[model samples]
Target: MAVHRSRRWSFGGLALLVSAGLASAVLINTSDAATNRANAATVTTTTTFSDDFDGAAGSAPDSAKWSLETGGSGNGNHELEYYTNSTSNAALDGKGDLVVTARKNTDSGLQCWYGTCQYTSARLNTAKTFTQKYGHFESRIKVPKGQGVWPAFWMLGDDLGSVGWPGSGEIDVMENVGYEPGTVHGTIHGPGYSGAGGLGAAYTLPNGTSFADDFHTFAVDWSPSAITWSVDGQTYETRTPADAGSNKWVFDHPFDIILNFAVGGDWPGNPDSSTSFPQTMTVDYVHVTTSDSGSTSGSTGGSTGGTTRTGAIKGIGGMCVDVAGGSSDDGTPIQLHNCTGNDAQKWTLGSDGTVRALGKCLDVKAASHDDGAVVQLYTCNGTSAQQWTYTSAKDLTNTGADKCLDAKDNSSADGTRLQIWTCSGNANQKWTVG
Candidate 1:
């Protein structure tokens, strides 16, 4: 087993070692556009729950949640051998994280159709098992160092089986290698530019540190109007359907997640003589979250001036409130109030981790808080009551109970107090703002 590289690496000579070619091009355009695709017929299924590799003991991924894809002819680049389901390639422990190890192994029984193949590794996905239309998708990962070591956390359309690649669309959440240690790329691939001509962008971290050294969170927030990529919590790049040419707007469809570590490929070129073997991409965890249509209303704030609201708070001070009424519990309906010190006015914005508010952290009471449960302000401790989540539809639920914040009798009138009630599929539970 190779020691995981989780600290940033040195990149002092990157400027001289690599030429600035087409990779530095930044195509700038201006247009406010969004895709108006009919919502895909989604099944109302129970959400899957799993550990996020953040606990005491780290474990393997859930076998039921992932499927390994092996065999590689070196797509575009002459690379190493395929990763079979053997000891030297892949393994899953069901704890929510997957480890894909690459090493020089001759008897691994895996062979690639391309150049001097001598290694095995892994590629995993949640294709047929689970797919989401719109939400936040993120992965905490540490990539391997060395030229030609290509590791990517990306997504492809779930309908790829029928529609095929490119036409189904591709979303590269993170792609990094040893050569460009401090820089990572995020791109979307569709019909016209699917393979190499696709539209994308690259972000370089502060000079001196490379991603291979530390575990960084790569994420994308997909919504109706636009898509934005971020490192940790900072925005890097954003794209809208209008920015894509007519045939390239395949992002309207649902996409499944994929995590893979590839050796030498056409893009990254081949590993040089100085390259080291046994490179590995260690994943901390992967999380997916979705919102109901119009659950919360607010704008996504970032360094960019364009503010498009898509449920989640894109930046600090992003708030969603019901200024017209109070709660059925006789409490005031939570409003997107300013960051005041008041308990009822404060809100803890989370990407996928957890929620915090006031001096105490909010949790889902009993870890089963369902529909209509009174969402009260509690201590900042990590408890169930403070764990309230608003889906794309804006239905707020405490994970500890079965109650939800329900509009009293589904009233649209002013002052319609939000009360705790049984989980009922009604307009009262439906919130649409973003």
Candidate 2:
């Protein structure tokens, strides 16, 4: 099982999630941050592979770039669905889309690897004819509605047969649980950091717009050392080897891409009374580009910029805001620890007033303004507690509270708790970047 990590999610550009107690469409206003990010993600160049789903109605996925992964053994998620290669489960619609449907399992006598098959869906992968080390990968997809529908576009290391799981690595470009249709998840799983402990982020749409209402583009700009995830064209998150604490960086190798719609798993749980069957994941297109020209990624800029925004945020004691135990949970103490060039210690300052790492905002607990409110990682909600400013003097301040981020007791030790205190102009309250 993938261990669940505490995470950060932002409502920056959420216009609406159209729903009547269920996720539907999302309104993307031009002024929304998510919209801007989505638009920013679409700038592109030369392509290595592009599929518009223009195949004849009911045709299978291109045999050259994709193959079916079939089974019902839950694939380790204890899911209730049976993955099959049947055309009925995955076929091209006459309307320029590839529709992968999940229906009630009619094969009463068919046995799953673990239990009885209760549902049936399709799983496709680009393993045999397609594998790449780094580049941009994007897809235009419309996820299914109703609870229990788990749609995803992801990738796995091509060396899965040789190294297995965490060693092979997994990059989830996009995954949407039916219940949270307005939200999308991007994650990376690798040695010592697979499953729920995966480094991840979430992008949610505004209210009144259901993702199921229309198609949206989800993409990732991947390079040798980093990967940036985006929705539409808006880049929201990026992960790199530095984020991998003591874990092995397993993403430098080639990987095979995958697309699937699962039902009833540990994350989404099982279907309920209101859950609808016959869910479908519609795909308008899939494209891969090799051009790094004009690419936008958190790791896109020059490394030697000497800016604190791209590297460690060192404090008066030369300590940094380190991830506790290399854990990626939200609320992980942003303490002053010995600086290490890992994702846990990386901090990026955004024009949006956020100091972020691992796709989460550095937040003050509860927006409190008390004498000793501690700072922690939280979902970036654009809240006052999240609004911050790193000054020229190198002090990290909560602009909303006007308090300097302080390392408790002037401590420079590992595991020291961090808090907000009135500026004292002391070295203990000072900080530096890069």
Candidate 3:
């Protein structure tokens, strides 16, 4: 099990940095902070793995699917729980759920990093049974409530034994500390962006309803180009290589799953007088679906399904549609530049009806419908602003604005910014969908 850290995070483009032990985060770029959440339907997928915890009450999880990780070293997060393989710590409920409990017990005579063990809990993992590259990975869970209680569903790259953390990479699909009962986080950690500096975002329940009150779905749609996080089907954030600043994106390999209920970690602090013990995190199921080809199908409401086209999009003066500086950061200008065959000049026409490069979508600025609106590379939100239609005539049009992608001022020279204008079938608006 990989012990992770947390810190400053975001929701859309809003900045909210929180510190957890030695971790903290900084704002790197803009995201599509839409008031309305994305409800776009997804493409087809094939079930790859599933577990419903449907064994007899008090029974352990199927040995074929899970391995109990026993320890009291705090897993590097300063956690207070001494993990055990006993049924008292982890068992399947007759009601079709797996319950991992944390209890305030000293009878085990366990030794922790702080001396005597104060609590006992369970950490279950699929490290030996399963590993996958890219797809939709999800879990439905009901967390425990009380200060110092932490529940998380996450993954670590299978290369941990060789490359180690932040190098092997980690993805937190859902994580919650007791202090924030209505909120859960989704984060990713990699080189140059680990610990408190990890990039992530928060999703809070409306009307302040606690997650402990019911089961909720937390998931991430992962592909070679981007990772999108959603809570109960509502998309709250998406991260691409651009969001990593200048750091390398290390999520292109296989990873294994982890589920744990911790107590008194560095992020949640020590359990206090008001805290309750014997807290249990109930998991309804863990399900994963993948694209047969090893990458996720394009997002919803764009192209139905087709082979991805990657190359340069040639326009007037034979210049290519390029991302400024080859940066994946949101708001990076989409312009016409001399074909250098570099990553900046590379564009992918996805089956999702979006044009992309550097892990971002070609977006219409602010979802604007007005002519002369700037076009840039932003997070893929499956919104009309990010959807494009490539016609047989080689015209790249924004579906929402219904405008042709135009070269500003009809200039063919390099560094010409691209914009959306009323369709005119002019040479500047014509493009080759590479």
Candidate 4:
């Protein structure tokens, strides 16, 4: 599992690695990717939470805003680093930075739950400390780079323990792999779109500028209906219900913030000969604001200039998808009715993981992915059942079940119910959206 390139790694136990030819040990060069992105956003001064990390070097992070999460249970990604609460792994640098370091564990007798420890890092969260439903969440940081390095600033639902991952929802504000020193990613994950399949996009520095060379702000402006992702204030992506296809949207609840640095896992794979030890991800600040000063109107709009894709989800028999009777009810049967070019068939796919119609979303009932699980029109909540991916093959598959959105019995009738079924490459399971 010694991959050497840039690619996403899921939290489950699978691995995929590719090498994009990163210059080894390149001296840090300055860039304005962060400054430009930041100047593009209008974050309000009304603060709901903030930490400048002004503590003296060697001290722990503020206990009121962050709790150190320890252990190395692979975090469900089959990661290779032991997470620790030790000051050596995470502590404020005298220079006003929260340094989360990944190092080669030197204690010979020390072992992880699985085997002898080789690496150690840190994970910090605001689990029971501070959870919020919406607003602006931002952080300024300089990330480290090297093969197998995985650094992220993200959030999870406060009910994570009870609901578990995808059901609890995950929002990745910023994540950078060491092999891709010039790029960073932001994504949202639920039961369906967790791991590498989570809906997201990468922001690459212009002219091959390395993001690891300088500090930049990563952020998301979240509302009841949509989420807008940005880098340094430059809005690059926005997601809504329609973007999730037939998956459920499950992000309306409160969530906790998390920051972690991982090494040698599924996506980035294991570090090899060129990899270095004792890497650090430095954070200068973390802030949250409840202000609406930077929001866009309507159920799907944002100021960050993120991509907004709108089209029709045309399925079998050349019919367009629709909400039966164009109703707004929760269980309105999704059908393959005639294309009337009305709002009932209008779908807006967004950077956020949602597929929206009539301002509602296409969702899998109860988040089920069974062969016959029903699809319906429902209010968006950022759940997995509502997450959709329009693959190159034109198949509409649910992230949760990995099943194709199918026409019941291959029927072309106006009121045929849509369901998830085994993807057999049949006409009934293929779809087209522009």
Candidate 5:
């Protein structure tokens, strides 16, 4: 069994090499045009999440979608870098890239497992912002060079705090050790099959090209029963339960995405004189597309499995969603009102992803997708503009606009109009569909 190459090391400082044979696992390349189309036609996909790093240069990652992890505890891998929340270590490039840099530590005075921190880098995760079960998660990254560097794009089960470590499951969508310039690995860790024993395969680029030479896409198409790895649109290996070696398959639950660059660890040894300072991992973009067959537990307003749930949508300040003047007209304003249990406040989460009151559908005015688009009660028309999804996070989103149903100006006054706005996971956009 290969020792898990990158993780919080817990084997009493045991240093083992990942079996060279593991790299020999068969690569199921799908570079053929026919194969690509056939694979694409099998599943209908929808964009669920994306981050293009389009912010101004030196700006921090979006707080609504990513959180920086700061520490020097070696992340259980005996790494030498002190992870910092500073933009000096991670920030947008303005040219649409998230640059994560690892530089020689100077006078920060940060301590590491080895007494003093020798490097400074950054690590970011989406644990608080988002989590998804089965989807196509991908990122385009240009890796850095140097023997002691380690860059990874991965995910951990959302229940990590509860179950802990390997029990919580890990999916290493892509990991590259600086020494292995031409190859990347994808692995999964869980109970009974963790660390070096993780199930996955290594993929090497054709020719003698080094990954550090340019950007390349790394992705995983995850399903309930399997996870397929790919590079630059080329399908590689796929892992399934049968490969778990009798242990349980734990990838069925939601997981949060993580990206980081490390310096010196159990897998990639300490930097030597030949190693360079200030290595960086440049990320072009990160995207996750959900499958039509998959279920997003925290997704807002969508079909309720054919069940029509009639109730009041209690929102901020405990106000219920209401239709102005209890009207059934084609364009009646939707508002926040005191819970009166009247027809104007009664709503039904229909089987077709429609929210209705008085036979009128909750809709985005003029089918607009702009922020602050007015939300109104319009005659049911079976159109995308009328579709809404209620997520576990209490967000009621207008599907056509891909925005959350928000209380205008964050007000809860009796006639505060409803509007559609970017989902910021704020109190103004939260609702309880009872």
Candidate 6:
């Protein structure tokens, strides 16, 4: 039996509201933004890597890049024994591939942070080791069987600590449980209703065969405009920011990858008595690739260099109107006023790449400069504040100092704010070219 603790993090909700507010205000007139630019530049095609990992040795194991999460103790109906370089739980190599096995512990002696659970398992990640901005990510995996078992290959923004969990963004390339053997899910999570509120689509394997029975290639083709999920080479689901309202879309940033097998939780539910113990998730290898010439496509349109608008500001709410100038400055209280085509509301994209509006350059709030600061327009200083770089590959980079435009606090609310921060190389910083 495992005991779980539930604590409400109000700050997360507040941050989301702020983020929504900001996005709404700045993103208004999305159509106008779209009309401003011409067609984008053509994309050059290139392959980043094609790996088989069939070598007898010198192959990269989960160990080189993954770390486990332990002590979950059945919290959220979870069944895995937490493996944190401590006692009972550990990751091992089974033959040629990496294996994460879950076992039942007979002894009631071990205690977990939440309470008690008689199980152990492994969860792995590439937090500090490596991360990809945009590319085709694929993995050959063999899932475990029995109810309550939840297996997943996913990605999260690398800036977890600074920006927090869902705020940083989550991408579930593949997720399946024992009960739903033939169905796999792909989803994205951000501020508003992340975690339990994650939004996604699902695919059912053909021939009545469950993914648990064989090694299947689970992959995601991630680009600026859309993200498509596939099994083997078959695409099952696709999501685009344009499809959903802008508030629900945040896949434009960089995200780190993760693989894990959990026992149960709010979504998968706990396993029953018939559930088997000592289940395993075998991973053959993971591969990542990007185009060489730097061109990609999707709903957001390609980068052409002429004025091209990919997305736009929809509506502004709760913005202070009486503020002095629209110049980009630190701590400027941004307000929502009627669109006057004035410099304040007229955000301009300079050929030099700066986002200027209201006589000010788009500025990071005081450069508090932390991961979650709000974004505001300030007077142009030609400092990093006014320098922007557009990539033919469909991402916007802050050439000013390698920094990137960020949503304040990573919130997904209607009035959340925006700001500039040091680039964590996450998808949130990745902007589509159009």
Clashes per candidate, residues 3 or more apart or on different chains: 65, 40, 3, 43, 14, 56
**RMSD in Å for all candidates:** 13.6, 14.6, 13.2, 19.2, 19.3, 19.0
Any idea how many clashes model 4 has? 43
Tens-place lDDT per residue, model 5, 113-196, is 788889999988777777766666779999998899999998877666667778778888888887889999988888988887
> lDDT tens string, model 1, 1-434?
11112211111111111000001001112221111101211211112222264432333445566656656555434555475555456553345445677877666344468544577887766664655555566778888888878898887765555666666677788888668888888877777765556667887877578998888888776665567776764455677888775665877655667777877655666678877877778787786643332221111111111122322221112333332222223222343333233333333333332333322333433444344443443333445454444444444444345355566655655434445566455656654332
Error of 1 at 198 (Å): 1.7
Worst 10 residues of 6 by lDDT: 17-26
**Candidate 4: tens digits of C-alpha lDDT, residues 344-428:** 8877653334576755778999998689999998976768787665455666666666677899999988888999886677899
Report the lDDT tens digits of candidate 3 across residue range 223-260: 66677666654456677889888898988777777888
Model 5, 277: alpha-carbon shift in Å? 1.3
C-alpha TM-score for every candidate: 0.58, 0.59, 0.61, 0.59, 0.62, 0.54
Model 6 global lDDT (CA atoms, 0 to 1): 0.52
Show model 1 residue runs off by greater than 4 Å: 1-60, 92-97, 292-434
User: How well does candidate 6 score on lDDT at residue 117?
Assistant: 54
Supply candidate 3's per-residue lDDT for 82: 85
Q: Between candidates 2 and 4, which one is better according to lDDT?
A: 4
Taking the tens digit of each residue's C-alpha lDDT, what string does model 6 give over 376-413?
65665546545554443323434433445544454334
In terms of lDDT, model 1 sits at 0.52
* Cα-based lDDT for every prediction: 0.52, 0.68, 0.73, 0.69, 0.73, 0.52
Model 2 worst lDDT window (10 residues): 16-25
Order of the predicted models by TM-score, top scorer first: 5, 3, 2, 4, 1, 6
